[model samples]
Target: MDTLTLQSTIRMNNGVEIPRFGLGTFQSKAGEETYNAVRWALEMGYRHIDTAALYGNEEDVGRAIADSGIPREEIFLVTKVWNDDQGYESTLRALEASLRHLKTDYVDLYLIHWPVKGLRHETWKAMVEIYKQGKARAVGVSNYTIRHLEELLSNTELVPAANQIEFSPFLYRKALLEYCVQHGIVVEAYSPLARAQKLEDPRLTAMAQKYGKTPAQIALRWALQHDLVVIPKSVRKERILENASIFDFELSAEDMAEMDTWNEDYWTISESYNPECSPRWE
Candidate 1:
């Protein structure tokens, strides 16, 4: 297997380099908590950070980045437009707000937080314009299924550079992963640790013992070995550091296939987020 490290990156369709592992800031509060987490991650050599406007932590994330003394170009930053902010003009304004909150001129990648029912196409058009204006190095969507991807591909000119989704050994959406791969879209795993849902499963625990690593490491290694980007979120310093320690070991192919059998199509996000069953357009 190829060696992996903190600096390992995968090139997107737009030719932008994105780290294979990143710090995810979901549900992280918008002040010192988030600021400290991001700061520590950066100080610990993390080069990529993912946040979304809906997380309400962009300001803190920006503060952490600014305080880290890391050069802006050295970090790959990402943020998304929220559902209500999913129209052409609105998305343009939303990006401006995100940029201001992030205290940056542009984001490495800007994504649609969800494929909001009717406005997705228009929102995507705005995203393309944002890309053309150099405000977003690359554009993408989150929680998008193959059906949603098809819609975007059939209507938009630029293919999404990434798709952020709930993924783990247990909730693995293999077909979606395959679709994204076939379309040259990088699949980023959120809830990559199953939000701790299966972290203590006997299978994971057994694997952990075999590898002499924590169950969390085993879970993360599973994602990394599949060549998918994994961002396991945590605000605690030790946990933050622990999340990045998956690069040192390799999971065997047999183990990989065994982990693959754990999938149960579980949905970790709130019920309202089901792409096929979103609430009525607002």
Candidate 2:
């Protein structure tokens, strides 16, 4: 963990290398806000950028990358197929639309944004096809639970290269993380800081003081130390810089265990929107 830098990457199952830390553009607005945020992140040495068709910022993200003057292959770009576009044919069409918006012929990684009930299997089939055709270097899923993963594995010969999930000290998903690891699927953590909902907690703040870092850094560092790829979102230049300045320190083993106790199954997304709680997942 001490040797990790902003440039460090984890190799996916398909031999694609993904930067372990990245910028998340979930709620980042579609225009200049998303564009500048991505530009700042790239300037700060972030090579991976996570966006989606649902985010409505792929063009902004693409423009920022193109304008950054960085070679396209140097940046590990990721985008997702939204729930509404989950069928096999529509999934293929969705990636094409996303590519047109991102202004790229291929994505470093492509994901099914959600496990849209009854459509996820077909969606996975399309994802496999995309991967085979080189449209995506690797294909995976997001917001998937253990059951969903089990169902996917049981039905498909190809294992997902990664699984993006909402993970943090405040929403520790130990079982899910372990399950992914056992299956050789990398876990990418979104909302790694729990959307700042618990950043002000006394325990987290105290740890931040102990490490001379911000609570957000502590949370992101924890995720990194756990070997999870973490993408924390921020639009402000200062915050973007702050989020990337997490590699200089390491949390003690005792403190890591203490933070693990902070989990309450908390979620920033409402119950109706939380994928874990959706009846469709059953």
Candidate 3:
């Protein structure tokens, strides 16, 4: 197995380098909570931070980055355009709003938060424009299924550089991961630890003991071994430090295979909201 590190990165189809491990600021609140989280993550050597317009914490994220004094060029900042903001003109405007909130001239990565059926194609057009103009180092999609990706591919010449999804051993989505890999789209796992819902499962706990790591670490290591980018969310200082400690060990192939079997289509996000089953993507 290849060695990995806290600062390791994966190159996108467009040749932009994205850190393999990142901090996900999904439900992290605005103000002090979100601010401290990003600050702590950066202090601990994290170079990537994922947020979205819908997260309502972009200002705080940007504030933390600015205060870190780590040189903006060193951090891979990412934000998304929300559902209501899906359209050619609106999407373009959304990026501007995000840039303003993020207090940066441009984002390292900008993504379509969700595939809003009729509007997603036009949104991609805006994403292409954003890339061409250099406002985003790379453009990608989040919560996109194979059908959604195929439709965008059929219509546009620009392939997304990454695809963010609620992925973990419990919700493996093997076919989706394989398709992303085959097409050179990096798969980024958002809820890599399954939102702590399955952290106590005997199987996972046993594996954790075997590796002398926490269940969260085992889950994150599993994702890393599969070559997927992981952005496990946490606001606490200890958890932020703990999440980045997966670099010291690698899971054995047999254990990896066993974890793969643990997939039951479990999702930290509700199934109704899952891109595969969501009517919003139809």
- The superposed Cα distance between candidate 2 and the true structure at residue 111, in angstroms, equals 0.5
Q: Which candidate, 1 or 3, has the higher TM-score? A: 3
- My TM-score estimates for the predictions, one after another, are 0.97, 0.98, 0.99
RMSD of 1: 1.4
**Worst ten-residue run, lDDT, model 3?**
271-280
Clashing pairs in 1: none
TM-score (C-alpha, index-matched) for candidate 1? 0.97
- Predictions in order: lDDT: 0.92, 0.94, 0.94
Clashing pairs in 2: none
Q: Sort the predicted structures by TM-score, highest score first.
A: 3, 2, 1
Between candidates 1 and 2, the lDDT winner: 2
Model 1, 1-282: lDDT tens digits are 769998799999999999999999998887999999999999998999999989999999999999999999999999999998999999999999999999999999999998887899999999999999999999999989898898789988899999998999988888999999999999999999888878879999999999999999999999988889989899999999999988888999899999999888777777676664666422
Report the error of model 2 at residue 113, Å.
0.6
